[model samples]
Target: MAKPKSGAKKATPVGKTGAKPAAKKDKSSRLDLIKNASKRVATTTTKVVKAAGDAPAKGSKSAAKKAAPEAEQPKEKVSEKTAEKASTKKSAAKAAPAAKTATAKTAPAAKAATGAKASSGKSGSKAAAAPAVPAVEKPRPRATKLPPPGEPLTKREMEQLLTAGEGRGVMGEGSLKGRLVVLNEMPNLVVVGRDKRELTFLLQGPDQEVLPAYVNHKVSVSGMIRKTTNHGGVVDVRKYSAKKPEAEVVEAPPADTEPRLRYLSPGEVSMVTAAGMGAGIKGFAAVRGNLEMTGEEFVLVVSNGGTRQQVSFIIDGKAAAKGLRKNVGHTLQVMGVVDKTSGWGGRISAENVEPRPSEARAVSRDEMELVHIEGEVPTSVDVKLNHGLTVRLPEQPGFTWAIEPTVAKRVGLREANFEPGPNGGPATREFFFTPRNPGTFEVEFFLAKALAPGLVDRSFKINVTVKP
Candidate 1:
């Protein structure tokens, strides 16, 4: 070689440099390699973005590292231009997680929108598959009209009237005649018409206070009447009057019908006793007393004018004896012939034995003259013989009235009775007497215990004269 130009450098021998200087890479070829690496980085970044959205967020950095290696491999062989492109690819790989975050945020909203459309479509299909139903009609009730006030009610109308108005009674104005009676402690009227049909009315008015006095008497009442039931009603009495019912008259039988057996009169009985039939009296007498068994005979203990007398009964048959035994301790009336064969004590051959209606018959106030004496009397009180005299006084518990034996003989005690006080008050005792003989005598009474007559609580005395 000629002498080199001034700017020209000489080439080193290959053997002396040990190795030929590496051939300078072509810029275009290096550019091509960098571009290809950029393409691979972009593809890998796209794959990483897709995987980051499906996989966990921690894998994003690892994906970036893998793509970095591909971008850095080209840097060793590339020029400045290749380095710049590789830097761009690395930036894109890092941005993939951000893009994946944005995709995750919008996913739930898109899914909800799709589910709404599917549910609406399903509801529409179900509604079209169902069937329709028809509605039913109901019946209405008719109204009833009442008849005029003055017109008479027909049988059908009467039945309807009774069944229709319950609790609210039908009003009317009429007069009714009935017998006033007391039922359930309330005054009610019972009416029996010509057909003998009875109708009861519960009386409710100002006259209710006086209705009790008219009980069991015929009454005529007129006012506003309310029919509560078919057979009963309520009466608001404006005017009322009560009357006593007339007594029914029974005709006597003919005199020749039959001769009835008659009992002995008081005068005839006394005459027969005064005749002195010692052997056996041929007369019938009725004796009333409590039957008692003495020895083998049944004796009737009779209380006559405060004097007790025993009359033995001669029972005829076993049936009569059994019947009289059942009546022991009970007051009985025995009617038979008197046999005076046992001296003064007479025995009755019983013809019939019957129980008395009551232990003691009630004496009528109109049949006898009554004389009332109370407390103590110094002067003699005149009284008619055989008339009743009553001594009334306040009673004491556990004490009884005792009379002198001599005074009791002359003034025989008929009965001793007790009258209960009204409204739970103190009670009173009454001693009834009839003078057996006409004489002036002093009657003394002591209120004392029956077992101890000497211990007296109180005493009363009275002088009485009986006129024949």
Candidate 2:
């Protein structure tokens, strides 16, 4: 059997969009773990550490009463107020895992220190000692030896080169010069020159003398040439000193030919990327945002002040990355090749774009049409629209006093829809719909509009048919 045709009204389009699939947001891995843990805790929550009034952690008791040989007043441990305090100890332990092993390895010393600190209550001593702790600065990966070459290399960088040399087993031989590029960050110094030759050398001592140089500095070098298919070509950089480079001027588009897009105001014009206009011509400006470049042809937005309209048009060539940015904003000017968007065909193109001064005042309009009328319109009555919108036929243009009913005694004329006359004058139209059916019937528009701020209608009616 044939399936019944769906009576559901077709969804009107906005910005050429269909009933888009509901977007499915990806679940964050971190948030997922947190949520799972939270859920588990919510179901099988354990000990609830209720917050007591703020006070020193674990309040002191009166030296433990001497009942039945009170245990020797246990020594108190030092408290670390913040998380940072533990980091120092943790780093120290990790640095020498073989020696620290476990808490048992140094518990005695730690316990003794805690006792001494607590007994003395010399908090200032601990604070002073903290400054002495060699702030083991984490090794930063800095591209070493970059300057006009006179200044010495930075400290951490010197250490890195020596460490690299030790790994390479060639400490002094690795002379860095020419177009220096870092390859690896660890073990040894593996770099390539401007010409693309590999240099794997090691640092014998902790010094900046082993690092490389770059910038507006030039160097003279003579070394074995090396080349690769995938990577490129280069000469082994060896034996060279830094020298200054000469200056030169750069070329650009002709001054007059170099046109720029000047948006009349701080607003945007956004067209669908598929609108067919990509980057316009290379030298000129892009097509106006009102034009819709598409796989087929470009449609332009043309509006005659009173009632005409601007339409989307397709011109061959690329379009700019600009268009109407805001849903309601107007396009002022366009220039250059408009790039065709990805997945969008490169067929339609805009040569150049310039926003017409008249384009300055673009507006969003709501076009509504009545499709059906429910119930009856009694003499001297007003109908409420489906969406609770209050609309009357005379309120719109080009339509007025069109419908005539036999049962209705009198029809009111409260509104009128008028347009511009073809001969350059104002045009007016009227419609007066009177009903005799005393039932349900629908009133529909003869045609539909294809433009901005689509009309939103929810049926209109007078409730004379339903029982009161």
Candidate 3:
């Protein structure tokens, strides 16, 4: 036969020289294959050995003998290419478990890692992976960022803005611009800027776990304001101080005609806070409330605001500036008997006023909207100013002692008069009147009873009737 082609099978070698190339090549390759297979198997065997204290795998020796008997089989049948492919398939099938095992090993190691090295590793991994998500949104804005208090406002500015009343300090948050301090250790820090327009701020620090603490005195604080789901935003406090000194007054039990009065009796200042809550001193919403005294003087300061106002009452028939603190901010409950006084600022008087129990304070976003009534209110007097007829007006119940004339001649009015009402006290005057004509007209009655800075400055209208 012709010499076999180079690409074809080699001829059987009979001599030792040729034996080196064919026999040695086959044996070495066989050994290499066994070595490679042993290595691959070692991966699994190593795990078993480590777990069981390095003992030989059960039946491994028997399996080795069985594999040796298969060596005589044509090695070409189990070619390297075929073995490699099988190994690759086996590896692919065990991929998940192999990775999991690696991770299992790493878990304990990862937990044991210490120092910034470990932390940095975790953070770096998180940072890299987290950035992969491209759709995370940003938070919305509430108000303009404000400089944290103490960081900005000087002590002098704070003192100048919030000092004792009576021209001593700028009018309560109305006049000047100063730092808004959300005080701690007061009754409640819900003190709104008192007005809508205020400084911009956002609550900066608050793990937001606990609320700030407040006690019975009016405290001052400075902080960063933040908007909260709460009607108003919460304040992040920085510095605070309680500012309730004391007052002059005596406390006695309530009188006979008064409502259920506690903590307050006669000759004491009744802190009228609400509009119509008729009750005792405890009626104070008790937010930042305290019963303090100063040498024969008793005072009840409110965290919401100072109770009892001072109004100028017609005491002793003299225009004296008196401090009147009664029935302010109340709707339903009328204050105590009006008493005149002297040595007070502006027009003021004292009355037995209590905390308003009925009126609920407006929260942050509540409708503080006011509905202005257009229709005129009926007063005790109905004046007709027409045909040049001026009549003396009749008196009313509370305003019997008329201080001004109530007669005039105008378009639809003919005449009017004023008379006294029931139980006119020494300081109060009451009156009632009649109109001679028929027409719509406006009137004013200075009840000589004013709790606010402005006296009984209410509006009244009269619909006069023409004589039939």
Candidate 4:
């Protein structure tokens, strides 16, 4: 046999040639497959490494197991080459899980960072959507500009101003009447009405300059008015006038004709007499009598020329002040209204008193020998014959003073007059007596009721000496 080529198989024996050729052919095909697989292993290893790197973390372990079998098959065919490749594949398979683990760990960090960014973005959006706070505004004072001096404001203008300044102040035209005064160093007008309702207004305008002169005087003004506050306002006076209070006038009672007379009833008489003289009567009459003033009041003794009975008349103080005292002892004609009347005497509110010529001579109070005693008296009293003794005692109601008949015959009671107490206090009764003869007698005075004379409220006994 010739020398065999390295790549070709040796010639086989003639009887075994067929089997040898078949075996040679089988070996040659196997070599070709090994060559092809060697080439594919490199490509597949690259593919497996890439797939391992790309696989998810959950599938990494299964992908490494499948690559291990593929690497082992190549290792059996070519131990040297496949062993190196197998180790490479095994390392890649091992690195696949490590890479997956690293990716898994890094994934949460990236997600957390991304979530933080998203939350920050959401907060920024909320801040942008929120409403901004508004700034507070301060209150401004009302404008006090006045209208030009001319005709009063028109009705429409006044209404508009009032409506605009409802809670504040407004200026308009109106009239006011009140007393002008200075309050709080500012001139103001005060109006006091019925039921204690009062309104005050501050004064403004040119007329306000003269407000001091019109203090306490009634003032009437017409001009623009401005209300600065709810309680009061201001007045821009255009025209104003002040007036002083007038004096009151009193007219005297009419002294025309004398008033008509009304007689007193019996009950009225008793009451008047008990209160003593100077009591008021409800009538008017005219009489001519002698005017005599008993220091307390004026008495008109009407003798009627000694023919008629003597009657006493108490003259009103006001009438007596009207020149009636000038004719104290003269006969006078008195014409006036009668206030009090009784069977014995009465009171006169004289309207006029004039002297009248008469034949009967009137005795004057100064010319008569009269003795006056008041309050307490001595146990013994002396009186001249044909002289008058006047005794005044406190007047008690429902009582009268009386003397014994024997004492009365000697010392006669001329008359009894009543003098009203000062300032409406208790009254007094005056008893006048004239002695008829010279004698020393015990005189008893008793204050008792007219109907029941025995019931005496008081009594007094005095020894009286009558001298010639």
TM-score of each: 0.24, 0.18, 0.24, 0.25
> How much is the lDDT of residue 444 in candidate 1?
75
Give the Cα error of residue 287 in candidate 3, in Å: 33
lDDT of 4 by residue, 123-195 (tens): 8889899967788876433323445554555665444333422323655677778888897656788865322
Model 3 agreement with the true structure over 383-455: per-residue lDDT tens digits: 3332222223332222211122332323322112111223532221112223335666444433322223234
Which candidate, 2 or 3, has the higher lDDT? 3
Better of 3 and 4 by TM-score: 4
Query: Clashes in model 1: which pairs?
Result: none
RMSD, one per candidate, in order:
28.3, 45.4, 20.9, 26.2
What's the CA error at residue 396 for candidate 4, in Å? Answer: 13
Better of 1 and 2 by lDDT: 1
All models: lDDT? Answer: 0.58, 0.31, 0.33, 0.60
How does model 1 score by TM-score? 0.24
What is the Cα-based TM-score of model 3?
Answer: 0.24
Query: Which residue pairs clash within candidate 4?
Result: 277-418, 281-339, 281-340, 282-339, 283-338, 284-338
Q: Once all C-alphas are superposed, what RMSD does model 3 give against the true structure?
A: 20.9
Candidate 1 local lDDT, 120-186, one digit each (tens): 6668778888756577665332212222234333454433323422324556666678899988666
Question: Which regions of candidate 2 are displaced past 4 Å?
Answer: 1-138, 141-420, 427-468
